[model samples]
Target: MLLEVRDLHVEFHTRDGVAQAVNGVSYGVEAGETLAVLGESGSGKSVTAQAVMGILDMPPGRITGGEVVFRGRDLLRLKEDERRRIRGAEMAMIFQDALSSLNPVLSVGDQLGEMFTVHRGMSRKDARAKAVELMDRVRIPAARERVRQYPHQFSGGMRQRIMIAMALALEPALIIADEPTTALDVTVQAQVMELLAELQREYRMGLILITHDLGVVADVADRIAVMYAGRIVESAPVHDIYKAPAHPYTRGLLDSIPRLDQKGRELYAIKGLPPNLMHIPPGCAFHPRCPLARDVCRTHEPPLYEVSGTRGSACHFWTECLNG
Candidate 1:
């Protein structure tokens, strides 16, 4: 495994109350493999990624428990300086919003070059050349000319590509992309995703793709983990989850996808809003919205039951769900 997150728990302390952001979330990604994390907003997808990257805002956020093992080492045990060394060199992240993430004052070249200058101790002249190389690698048109442009100069899709380029600049072993395709039109989204997949294949890097778009996950992910209220409710190979979702929440998500065959039919939507982390419901966090929820579901949290060697579901009636 290139990365393994075991029994992870993260909490956010707030004036209102302590919010359990990530509760025992566990998953792994092998080198060259893509693991897609699917969930609605506030499902802890991004928070988990932030924790893994060691970039969570610590004043409000704290990793209460769990081991984030990367390349045989527990990152949680590493010192701040040590973790910082590994963050971009060994494992990098592509944020959701490129515009906000990129420094407004810095030119694209300066921003990308900073990684080389800081990590590799390269001179400014050498770093600029490396920056141009990265832009070209990510297929940014007129890389030499565009390298000096500001982030505001690039289009949304191009800016996203630049984010991917920066993450790949150091040739990390793993990459965590949190909604890399957000805000782009459908065509642009497809282009960005395809480019990412191609780059991952070329680099053979482990990839953790976090998004709520089922269509995008279907196209790029090798395996899928469904999260609800900070917990992983189901995990399976991408195709298997699409063919037969074993948990009500996963099934609801699959059903909610717009089908080409059902053009005129009303869309299926999961009824209730996601539970607030600070006041997450007892038992199964999804019990209130689950169509297959029973008394057992309301009274006791279901453990992730092994459905197969490579699949697991956290629903009391997973068999019924799979069959249905």
Candidate 2:
């Protein structure tokens, strides 16, 4: 396995009280496979990625429990120096906003080359050469000239490509991309996702694609994990989940997407807002908004139960959900 997370829980200690962000989320990804985590905002998708990267803030956010095992090693147990050494070379992440995630003062080439210099101890001259090569690999036009340009000089899509190039620079065993194509045109989104798919094939790396846009991930993801209120409510192969969603929330998400085939029909939408993290509801977190919610769903949390071989759901009426 390239990565394994078991019973992960993350909490934040605000002045108000503790906010239970991620609760007992578990998933794994092997080399060359892609696991797309799909959920609306505040579903703990980005928080999970931050935890995996060991970048969660300590005073406010705390990893209450869990284990992040990567390549037979538990990342949570690694020393600071040890983890730092492995971060860029063994595991890398692409943040949501490349505009803010990238430093403005530095030229794009220097930023990309820093990874090589820090991890591989390459000289500035050699690293700059490698940076130009990376830019070309991501299909950035005018690689040599663009290398000297700052982050502010690139378009949203081009800036995103730069981020991808940096993430893949070391050929890390795993890459955690948090909405890599955000704020891009539809055409650019397609291009960025395709580039990621091609790069993953070449590197044989495990990928955790965190996004709310199921449309972007439909083609690349092997498995999909549906998260709600910090927990994974359902998980299965992408095809199985889309074809036969066992959880009400999963069904609701799929229904929300507009379809060309259903031309005259009103677009389906899940009612109500996502529960607040600071003051989440008891029991199954999705209970309040779930169409098929039962009395048990209100007060008694449902554990993820096997709906079929290798597929699971947190709903009380998994069999009935299939009929929906």
TM-score of each: 0.98, 0.97
Whose lDDT is greatest here? 1
Per-residue error at 137 for model 1, in Å? 0.7
Cα lDDT tens digits, model 1, 8-102, are 99999999999999999999999999999999999999999999999999979999999999999999999999999998999999988999999
Model 2 accuracy (lDDT, Cα): 0.92
lDDT of 2 by residue, 9-47 (tens): 999999988988999999999999999999888999999
Prediction 1 global C-alpha lDDT: 0.95
lDDT of every predicted structure (CA atoms): 0.95, 0.92
Off by over 4 Å in 2: none
Error of 1 at 107 (Å): 0.7
